[model samples]
Target: MKLKLNAISKSFGPVKANSNINLTVDNGEILGLLGENGAGKTTLMNILTGLYKPDSGTILIDNQLKEFQNPREANKSGVGMVHQHFMLVPVFSVTENIILGTEPTTRFNKIDLKTATDKVVKISSEYKLDVDPNALIEKLPVGIQQRVEIIKILLRNAEILIFDEPTAVLTPQEVTEFFEIIKSLKKTGKAIIFITHKLHEVLEICDRINVLRRGKIVGEAFPTKTNNKKLAELMVGRTVKLRTSRRKMEKGKELLKVNNLSILSDKKEPILTNIDLVLHQNEILGIAGVQGNGQTEFIEALTGLRKASTGKIVYFGKECINITPRKIHALGIRHIPEDRQKQGLIGDFSLIENIILNTYYEKDFSNNLKLNWLNAKKEARRIINQYDVRTNSEDISANKLSGGNQQKLLIGREMSRSINLLIASQPTRGVDVGSIEYIHSQIIKARNKGIGVILNSTELEEIIALSDRIIVFYEGKIIAEFPSNSDPKIIGLAMAGVK
Candidate 1:
């Protein structure tokens, strides 16, 4: 199968998301799509998948023009997308979920789930996916759940597959396995488009690379001929710094300490058990783990977003156990939450409003009677200028900004305040390389200024690059600790719950 998108142009009001973009993918080819946030990669993909219509464009499959009215139509034409976040239902079995919309019916018009399960098993075996047809999604590992998604598309006879950040949540071992799966798919004569923010993965897996900058196809390069620096430069349209530069410094006095911290879920089951750790001024305490191994719960407990069943949280010599989030903020503790859109900002709120979302009650922005709009707008503008949060006006809604810009705004708001400690979780998860560089520099800058930082991320490389010390979280416990320069293999094993 061969797919082609020609003269694709899309506009949302004044923003030109894609302008005359042209691309192609053939059978047995894996094409990597590289772009910065807001560079129209998503828009272009949406057009191809029938989620959106381009203002001007043509889609050709096997040299024949095709127009799809919806995602189902696109799927029928052999185009399928495996989203960054899996679209499977947690309570449903793999076969049930796969055959949801297109279930075969028996003579009595009842759903022929038995037939679907058999087909799923066959597809799984053919692709080496190794998924269980009867297994519930919630019981499966993330990597296995991903296989179910692949099996779903293959069962529909999809010839072209789009994987969006497929490895973002996978552990190191799972990533290796995923790469092998991609290679197998390529060998089976499937045209693949792999979109990811990780430059190294693209260079390793892609046959050819096309970079998008400001809604335009800037350049194309083969993985064998180009490097990360060149690709990053092309995506951002500038000379980009791929790594942060930091000077060595001694770790200062203890700024925050956790003692036997334990958190319980709503059902009274333990989520974090007897967690003890320390953070010192002028240091970045990196937390490494897979997505759900108590990292998010631990961060929530620290930020006072979740209650701890037992333990002490000491901040600057004050025992702040069970403190309110406001009190935590008052103690000069800042948090950049994991899910930016949900916890960091209010989508309908203006940029100026979001800048003061947590600080609106402060004296500078409020006087107990009315909000100081002038002061709030001034602070918002300052953050926009300082953080390079690309937006036209402070009056625009927070959701109007791109993912990277939204993150920068959140960081600027938190760091701008008088803070002693910063708790940043997944700080650069979905950001582009240029923004990652900037955010990393900011974290190191905070550390250099004698501020303690608890850096929690799923990206091991980020943790290794910026941390002074590292701790591995596994099934609600800190299994191991290591110096910043410790071997990643050992840490990775610890993350997978190895002793």
Candidate 2:
């Protein structure tokens, strides 16, 4: 027992983020902290890392009571946290960013770049995290930035590491490399607390697993003794069928057609190049790829958020290129944008306002003559009930909801529209176990009802499981297409542009 948390509790107003949470991690062991979004996982980790002060609890480090006032104090106590988003300064060199606060100084208080670079390199080599200390943070890929963060902690000689959703942005190969680094860290006598919603990775890397639900620890198990299905049941409090089941489609006529499409990014490079694809009614076509491979740009072009340089987009047998976003919505197309915070919903608006956002001008929820707040509230309540969006009140602001609930609200709102076609991108990203299952079912239901569906996700399992036909995107080009029943490793290889 290297670290033990006893009866930790925290709350925000009436909402308890964590309640009597008890957890333990042994030295040199990797423990998985499994939970859905807003299940108190992040809050507990923040308390451990000194970002939050627990309302009631005692933290025992080596059986001694300890409290951290801030992150630096936690660092001094041999605990470090790497957040889901990289925190490096883009323009700074790796060494500079690593030693930003804890600078190597002389008598004059000037930064000693040589000493900092030497320490960074030594830590990187010891952890097998090969990074150029002098390279600019922005010039490095996301994986290398992650390595720099880890090296920062190791350079301070941290004995315990906390990683929050570390592989969410990584490619499959990069995920493998990250696992190797984690294994190496464990061998170096460091206790690691791994936090993620990815069950496969938990089974692959963790020795013991802790499941948190509704701000409390619910269950514990050894990975070798339990499977994903069982762990999912414990986390969700129900026996959830993890796989997505879709019937063989009776393909209808084409609903959307893209011919010779090319899109230039703001940097004036071809982010989508000569792409041609079609989605037929009653079928789901999934585009699978690693991040930065042009999937975002492709989705933007189809959703009327970006313009195609030279191409023809025919939605419902009518030309649609260069149309405004409002025009696209009026044409009976519902798009769930990839970045929920930026594009999916208005963070400052109430749930009712967000639910009727694109269609509020219509006569159903509102009219050209007058607005109907009552009907809009009624419709919002319907979506909230149907989508299982857990909230105390629909009057709450959209940004106040958890990530999973926000995603659910977005999906429910879009699916409420009687659209001819639907475009969903990274729809299940950061959602919890139960919400993921429900969202997948809803998408399949929409396809079964004769609406053409275009699915984009970096998760290979999601693409493989939900798509009838899967296309691999590489550098803004469709490299290959495969049936959904193909082996997952095959698609994994395709996503890496190996095929």
Candidate 3:
């Protein structure tokens, strides 16, 4: 199948999400869609998959101009998209999920479960997806769940598959497996569109790369013709500093101490067990692990979001185990939560409102319970300009910003306030390369200024680059500890619970 998007444009009020876009994906070729967050990548894909109608464009599938009213219509036309967030029902079996929208029915109008399972099995085997037909999505690992998504697309007989940040949640090992699957799909002559923030992955997997900046196609490159630095520059329109300058500094007072910390899940299973760590001013303590191996719980405990069942959290010589999150923040502790959508920013609040979330009650932002909207906007403008938030107005809702820019807003709001300690989780999870570089530099600058930091990230390279010391977590326990200069292979082994 050959998919062509010609002169696509979309707008919401004054925000032009996509503008005059032209793209093509040929059969048996992987077209890499490179863009920063909110760079209209999602909007363009939505248009192609029939989620949103393009304001001024024509979609040509195999040179036939067609208008699709909905995703099912696009599916019938052989277009399918695997979203960044999985759309599977947690309780449903893999077979159920794959056959959800377009089920095979008998004359009696009943779902033919056996036929669905058989088709799923055939596709799984053909693509080496390694998915069990009867496996529940809730019980499957993230990587396996992604395979289920692929199987779903394949079952729909989609000739053109769109993957949006498909590997964002997968571990390094699972990434290799996914690459193999992409290779198999290419061999099957499928036209694939891979959307991701990871530059190296694009260079590794793509046949051709197109860069988008501010909703316009700015540049195109082949893997052999372009490098990470060039792609990053194209994406952000600037020379990016790819490395963080984390310099050695004099160790100051002990900032925090977690002794024998333990947490139990709702199932009464230990999620974090006997974790011990120390953070000192002027240092970054990076906690590295595969997702769900107690890193979330540990961060929650430290931030006062969750209580530790059996342990002590000592901060500046005072016990802070059961303190309220607000109290912790009052004590100069700031947190950049892992889930930005749910915890970091309120979707309905304006950019100015969200920027002053922590300090709205202060004299500058408010006076005797009345908000000073003018002052709030000024502060918002300052942060946006300083942090390079890609929004034109402070009145715009934080929800309107791109994922990367939302992160930047949060970092700006959090770091600008007076802080004694910073606990950042997945600091650059969905951000682009340029934003990642800037955020890393900010963290390093914080550490250099004698503020203690606790960094939790699934990316090992990030941990190695920013951490002065590193600890690996597995099965709710600290399996290994190493200096930042330690071999990554040993760290990888520790992350997999192979002590």
lDDT (Cα atoms) of all candidates against the true structure: 0.90, 0.88, 0.90
The clash numbers for all candidates, in the given order, read 0, 0, 0
Top candidate by TM-score: 3
Residue 192, model 1: lDDT of 97
- Model 2: per-residue Cα lDDT at residue 95: 95
Error of 1 at 194 (Å): 0.8
Please identify which of the two predictions, 2 or 3, would achieve the higher TM-score against the true structure: 3
What ranges in model 1 sit over 4 Å off? 85-118, 132-142, 264-270, 347-353, 367-378, 393-401, 496-499
Report the candidate with higher TM-score, 1 versus 3: 3
Global CA lDDT computed for model 1 = 0.90
Off by over 4 Å in 3: 91-96, 103-118, 133-136, 358-368
TM-score, per-candidate, Cα-based: 0.90, 0.90, 0.92
lDDT of 3 at 81: 93
lDDT by residue for model 1 over 1-499, one digit each (tens)? 9999999999877889899999999999999999987787777887898999889989999999989899999999999888765788989999999998999999999999989989998988887889889999988988999988888888888899998878766767789989999899999899999988899999999999999988999999999999998899889888987767778889999999999999988889889999999899999999999878899889998999988999999998889998899999998999999878779999899999999999999999999999999999999999999987867789989877766678888888988879899999988877889889888998999999999999999888899999999999999999999987778899888888888
Q: Tens-digit lDDT track for model 2 on 353-463?
A: 998889889998766888799999999999999988877688989977876678889999988867888899988877777889899999999889998899998888888
Q: Considering TM-score, where higher is better, how would the candidates rank from best to worst?
A: 3, 1, 2
Task: Provide the lDDT at 338 for model 1.
Answer: 83
